[model samples]
Target: MQHSVQLTYDQNHSLSWGKFVGSVLFAFFGAQIISGLFIGLPFMIYTAGLSDKKTIALYSSLGNTGGTLLQLLILLLFIFKYEPIKKLLLPVLNFQALQKVRTYIYLFLFFGLSIAIHIFIISKLFPHATQEQDLALNLENLNQYKILLILGSAIFVPIFEELIFRGIILQFFQQRFPFWIAAIGSSFIFGIAHIYSLGVMVGAFMMGMFMAVLCKKTNSIIPAMLFHMMNNTLAFLS
Candidate 1:
């Protein structure tokens, strides 16, 4: 009787479909709330009665960096607080996925194809399209916080993104759905997160699809993270 009860207890603790959905929503909205209340609110007060434009710029720069830190903190907390989510991290970070030569070849191939789709297909189709933001120019505008901005946008952004989108969302759905369903479902959400113009949305959708494919082929998220970091680094440099 005790053994059966223990098994039931374990099953309850495992991540449920509802639990996974809740975690994703919590991580996103929790970060937004924390940033607004703690970072933006405080900065607004600090800048009050100060008409100097530099003071306003300084406030924005600091607020932006603080917001990034808070978002990272919130997502990390959400992941570590759950036992099953923690288990997923090992498979996600598994280095064995890189042992096969075909994995490397696939990485290069998928990445190149994604670029081609984004540049040749999407951009050409909608000549006015761009990323949700001109991230490179944003960094330049907030040059006072360039280091923090770069780390936030380029490094930490990809880490949390792969962990959430591919690691959690895609994997969860893939267990019950077909691969195409899982990939498109996750990619759709991923692309929607960066939404603005139609072309930008399509391009992001293609990148998300490629990233999902990379994770599927390698059976890990590490390669996807590397691919994302490399992609973002080049964007900033260009």
Candidate 2:
């Protein structure tokens, strides 16, 4: 009787943990989408008369920033309320890890070169598949809001994304599953979250996998965050 009761208690505990993790994931994604629409709709309506590329880009950046801020706020609430989450996040924010500047520099160079080569080869094989025109159009308009664009893309976006995807989601999965299963599962969702063109989706998936690997290797999300920030900053400048 005692054995059966203990087993039942264990199952109940596991189920509760699963539900908490699921709630966290759902809350982050749901709040992000809703906040984006809430913030973006007003900007879009207000700028309807202006109708310039730069104005639109500025508003879009602002909307994105607002959405990211909402996610950050939500994550902060979870971190404070959950001891496990706080434990998971605290190490990633260690100042000692930030001092490994050279390691991050190498990581950025290696991944940047690898991705560039992959894109080049893919472009050669599929000449009609380039999304550069669309990317260029969007990025070019951000020239007027250069500083805001840089801060939003390089700093805020990376911090928000890495914390949610790698720090929370991936770690949560890793606790319940094998490493590869957790990594691939999180990376796939990360790609879907981008909602880009097919080629960009593939790129996002690959980038997500790479970042997941980096997080696993370092046992901290800070390295992945730094890489993401550099990657975004370069893409914005390019």
Candidate 3:
């Protein structure tokens, strides 16, 4: 009877984990698909010769931002409504007192680390990759669509990404597995999601790992989100 009870409990736990994982995956992918469609709508309209390329790109970027924000709103609703997800994410959302000096130190450290890894990835690891070149070209060409780029990259992307990866996925994995396993696994997924080139992937992985560590240390996703925003802002400026 005891053995049977234990087995039943384990089965229930596994089912719960499976359900949570499924919900998260659905939210993530569904948002992306929906956002892609929304973005494509503007392009299609532009192709109908109603708007210029820059106007279409700007509208597409706005659509992308709206989709991302909608995804976050849906995920936030889920997080609040679901007991399991709430329990997992409560620590991340809860306010905590932080030392000003220490906070600045950590911010600087993470920012510097992100820059160093990006430089190393571009210069040594994937020297032939045009990741930096592509970034520069994009920046140079952002005369009219600068607002769209800033809003999409510096604001929406960081918040949504941190909530999804650090707040939900990493915390869920940490519950089921060891810390390092969870961190690396989530970081790998994060890297793959941003896979434009080898250098970009490596940089993203490193940044993800760093953000994971920050989330773990602070027991809050706020810091990670801020760090991500800072990183994105730097990239935008550069």
Candidate 4:
């Protein structure tokens, strides 16, 4: 027999804030640590440090790709017992989600905003070198693992990221807060997860807000996922 558990919006309002922050932080770091151990255990036995480019690329690709997988798994676990989500996500995932005019509108607007962000903010935020230089160096280092990196960044990470940030966290906040508040709050954590690079952090924040709104507007995560996929793909190629 199947039973559906329905949680009220205000029933657990007191701890919502703490639960909000705790869930995001736990999932973010938990993914990193779990994936690190999963992929790093092998390198731990052989190399003290990754001096070899191939080793570094292999390590990065496997670790990152594996990390995204872990994140998805973790997010799934969080939503597993909640039976209501399937309905919100079930309606859209068709050709219309990708083909709808509004989807393109959101993508175009965010694409323009992303460029402005790179020009106005990211260029100045680069501490030691330019973002382009950083990317070029990373590409060079990836060597044989470049494809894996592309797959992780362009596909897996977007799905996992959107699932966690906009899908789970944003919805959690919405249960207790206003829509805008929920979007911004979840977007903030989305940005923080990409704290490794200032430019990426800034860009992620903006994109997160955009995707959150899109998710709300479309009533599905599919559009956000497509937008995220394109954004990461362009970023990796650039």
lDDT of 1 at 6: 48
lDDT against the true structure, per candidate, is 0.76, 0.70, 0.73, 0.68
lDDT digits (tens) for residues 124-194 of candidate 4: 67643345445644566554676786787788888777767776677777766799998888888888777
lDDT of 2: 0.70
Off-target runs (Cα >4 Å) in candidate 4 are: 1-9, 12-22, 44-52, 81-96, 124-140
Tell me model 4's lDDT, rounded to 2 decimals.
Answer: 0.68
Model 4: colliding residue pairs: none
User: Which residue pairs clash within candidate 2?
Assistant: none
In the predicted model 3, the residue pairs found to clash are none
Q: Rank order by TM-score, top first?
A: 3, 1, 2, 4
What's every prediction's RMSD, in angstroms? 4.0, 3.8, 3.3, 5.8
Model 4, 234: alpha-carbon shift in Å? Answer: 0.9
Can you write out model 3's per-residue Cα lDDT over 101-137, one digit (the tens) per residue? 5655676787788788778654587885455635634
Off by over 4 Å in 3: 1-4, 7-15, 37-43, 46-48, 97-100, 128-143
What ranges in model 1 sit over 4 Å off? Answer: 1-13, 47-55, 98-101, 135-140, 143-145
TM-score of each: 0.82, 0.76, 0.82, 0.73
**Count: clashes, candidate 1:** 0
* Predicted candidate 1 versus true structure: per-residue lDDT over 1-238, tens digit per residue: 4554444433554667777777778767776787779887888788786787766767767777677777878778878877777765656677888888988898889888877876778878987665445652355446565665567667887887888888888887776689989999999998888766677677777888998989888888888988887777666665
Candidates sorted by lDDT, best first: 1, 3, 2, 4
Cα lDDT tens digits, model 2, 57-169, are: 78766765665666667666767676756665676655465567655765676587656855776456545433553464465555567777778777877887887888777
